[model samples]
Target: MFSRRTVLTGMAAGLFAPYFHDVYAQSSALPARLVLVLECNGVYPRALLSTGTRAALGGRANTSDRLFWDAYKDTPLVREGDNLASAISLGPLAESAGKIDLVNRSAVLLGLSNLIAGGGHSSGTGGLSCAVNGAGATVDAVIAPRLRRGAPFDVLRLGTSSARVSIVYETCALGPRKPAGIIVNPSLAFDSTFGSLLGGSTNGRDRKMLFDFALADSRKALAEFKGNSNERLKLERYVSSLESLRTREDQLTGMADRVRPYLPVAPKDNPLLTGAGSPPDSLKWFEAQFQIATAALLGGLTNTVVLATGTSGFDVAYGPDVSDVARHNLQHGLDAGQNWEKVAEVTRRHVQLVANLARTLAATPEVGASGSMLDHTAIIFMSDNGEQHHSTSREWPKLVVGGNALGLKTDGRTVVYPKYDAPRNRQVSNLFNTLGHAFGDADFNTFGQEGSTRIAPGPLSELYG
Candidate 1:
């Protein structure tokens, strides 16, 4: 009666029974919502720090703009450990602007590896597994099956930009050679997900009849309750709830107009609605996608969402003065200045969007709890590529925010593993495994294929409080 999974899980438990006896447990029935922002074209981890930390750590920062340096910059690291959570900076406006402390609650992971993905090549599931081209399910899909139980959608994989090259655009894999489909059209995504409530499901009369019938049925049931007085009171409350449902439905009928503005703008003079339907690689399109994702999460349509944008060689603009340039070219040793500025700019923008989402969730109270929903949610910001353009798969930096509800240690502590040459260096698969363990899935001792890199089984013990 034992399947391969059961056997593997049992074997793993026996191996780690001594060290992880109490570390492993069942996944919480109320797990945190997952939002994955998959960045392409690598990241400049050194540029994110200050000159003092960068000098000690030997990083890159070739900027002459004092105003820029004064603004969107922070060391976040020291000789010993990271600065306390409050000292962390959010963006260029952090010094002058006052906002929420969402950024301070973030964690940065250094000294991580994939050992499988080649430079300038998207790993697909290879990032999570040794199987190339997503021979197995990636980390997001692995968590989706359990986190999104009974949700309207299994996992909402969305992105900006269509394929301009024959790279691994699809990150989620169903199995070997099977990449999950991603919806690149923003307007279509909105229509497919919320169209029913937007008057695209049934005609007005049919909808009215359904609501009317439900109300009448509930009222009749309330009148004929022949049980105890307490039972009669419950029936009356049920009848009242039916009437409330009708009011909510009527409110939804008129909400489409208000919702349209937040969606992608339609093409000019194009009846096919080509522009709006397609999620182009523009800032507006990305924001619109964020709006749709926020709505889906808030509406309880999906529990896990993955959003990806651009690629390594892709061209993008950071500032008004800075023209569009290819990220691959800028990600070099001598060209570190341009790369530092652009990466910082892009990261600030994306993190601002994350801040917006966190703010929205923070204001909204949890469904059946006392604190806000943000207390039970987590967001991961990581690059599909590693720490440099045309990376050697040596380092994959990551940022995780707001996983306290899932038992994660997110006290703004920046954890940097030893260098690859050092003894006991770790890879990202262990981080993914650590995540799986946090989510109560100890069966996945290690994700991906058995590549040449040496990796130990089990999660990073320091990541938990």
Candidate 2:
């Protein structure tokens, strides 16, 4: 039949086909891991560049219109041998002497654009899928199954919202029209991940019942559907979402024994666990999700994970720091009182959280590897949209930590591709292709919409060569 599932599968195989032999032909060494951390709206490029790097690019030091225009130029991270100069967003990663101790193990990427994603308000599924809006399988979906050695789950998708939503499905997808869910409620996420070990929690059991019923209903409805193509597409997406949840639940049950030993303790003093009858802000949820993700990675539950905050129409009002302006207003580059620092504060907080996760991984040793877990893992931090709140899909800034085991040349390096207007400029799809190459797919060059004449083909040789 001409169903969406078959079409999507075929398209994926054609667009970003994975070679089974190459993906599986790896030595006995432990597989490299991936953790993608994404924030919502947009990230100002200036917030991420160090003073010296900006100066080197002749960028004005202030946040005025002149400085905003200067951000489009090629600006690299200021480096001294093996150390990077401090940027406000990365200041938390620095030591007491104000030196970034993690510079030698990190890399900063700039000037890559994603016009194909159609950025505004948010990129939705396009952020990870690299396809417009909600089309195509996201990078996580394409890479997770290939990289998952023996993990119970294919990918761990956790998220935090400004609101008290239980789940949001804006940033990930399995295939065309198949959106992946981000568990926004920490309490529910904990129950989903670890609850089965203790015979399952009440919430988990109740939620499972609802999920099963919905899945059954969707399948029945799909079978009965003799509607138009648009209606059929909607039904297919709904069924796909339910099926994805069921698959995760089944995996959790089957892998309970394997996942039990590495279970992380439930978040302590978490507001979500306080029975407050309301969800806490993104700050509290971000910390909880991080704790859960660390456990999932270290425990061998999953080698690929995605942690999100303030994405997909979720809450962006972090605290009094941002003046509770939410995402739309904050994207204006001003709070209610014209406080630009508030915007920088939110961006810095995201970077701070990412840095802490990197430090934690660096501190722990890989169970079957010679170096620390960080050496074998890649932690990527980026904004869902491009630069600024109302993003123009130009000059996306990215930061990556570790992944030395995965052939990443991120040792205190700052790679700034040409601006989007330049003929030789690179796209985000190239970066994704580079990651696919790092994860053992040697010939995996065509990712996302790179087949288009507008985009260049192949992985970024500057990153992995």
Candidate 3:
């Protein structure tokens, strides 16, 4: 019988050998670790910021509502509780946020507005992915190629539902368009992607054999072009694509060597939903996807990823008490007293997901890098709109964490952009462009429609060191 290692080696060499040439020659100096966390219905600005006077809470000054007037003061020790006595008063999300290196390193993009023209929530969601005025490319697409020049999984666009899946569009050479690489139920994809990583199971061993066979074929094909530059490039990429796979295998090996062996529980027997149906066990599915994404990032499997927890038009039931209110419905009453409570709860759940992801990254140490895996990673967390009713983008909660290890800043207090005058609104594209530049896109100055009055030139200078 062929040894397991031999089989896996043979499969990777064979299957991945063909595509290595082109990918290796064209690579960029972007972050090898990146993640994008997007939420639906936006966040309530009032809750995220303090306004009234109550006395400075925590370590930082300006913890009262009066701090809202400054827009530049930072909350030192905002925590979650009934009384807003902490530095970064995050309300329900206090627990998770506290676990990470909490900093008001975020900045408000005042005067920024979404170019939502048609199609209610669905259309707006599409616009968020691409196009601030008309159909255009999104920030995720712009940075994906730069980060994963030699990797197989350049960008993993994942979502909880069908609508969420379409949030990241790809602008290819053909034209400005959307790419078809969405993993709607990423947990199932995770199982299939790293099947061999869960060794010991009969099914896993069989999958490993198949992968080995493919790798052997790829290796054979690569040998045919030994000295050719193009072929050598292809070989290099094939190796890079296997990074995540190799990491999984190493993890399994270590697990096997442990005194007490442990294995992931097999999935339940219920059929998960595909498109338009119930919520489809989002909590469980998302947690699994998070694990897979974290593994991929830690193993250098892929450099860029966009994970949409849910879509903008989602109306699934979160729980019995939460009601089956559509995301759009929650935003319409954001200004109302009672509506803020419901919105706060939904937003808190979303925040919890992000916090969980951050903590996971922080826990894992990098191979050749100092600090935890999260230290070298930059996570961009934001929503399509600030509220559901209007497309206004002012006071939008845009948080950037962990890039500080990558030379970005987030330790100081929150900084608000200069207010715009009159009816002219800043376009969300400006914010998008700023993100692109942050990831090392030198010529990435402008995005979206020309003269659309949506995208401004403000670079969000305060966000950087």
Best by TM-score: 2
lDDT of 2 at 251: 64
lDDT of 2 at 382: 85
Error of 2 at 278 (Å): 6.2
Q: Write the per-residue lDDT of candidate 1 for residues 250-327, one digit (tens) a residue.
A: 655555444433333332322323343322334444565666676656655567777766532234333233325444
The regions of model 2 sitting more than 4 angstroms off are: 1-29, 59-85, 97-100, 199-268, 271-279, 333-338, 450-453
| Candidate 2: tens digits of C-alpha lDDT, residues 76-188 | 33343333436657666566563336777787777788888888868888778777887788888788867688655667787776654677778888788878787776767
lDDT of 3 by residue, 1-465 (tens): 222232222111100111111222234453446677665445444444433212333222243221132332232222222222132324422335346433432222222445442323433333344343225545555566666744545565565543444233221111144333445455455454445454446766675566577667767777676577986996866755554454444444344332112223433432233322455545444545555565455445566666665553354345435435654555565555555576566655655666666666666665455666566677776655443435344434555556655555545334333333224334455555655656666556665554545534644454543
Clashing pairs in 1: 72-92, 129-448, 130-448, 130-449, 135-176
lDDT of each: 0.55, 0.68, 0.47
The candidate maximizing lDDT is: 2
What CA RMSD would candidate 1 show?
Answer: 15.1
TM-score, every prediction: 0.68, 0.78, 0.64
The Cα error of candidate 1 at residue 104, in Å, is 3.7
By summed lDDT, the worst window of 10 consecutive residues in model 1 runs over: 12-21
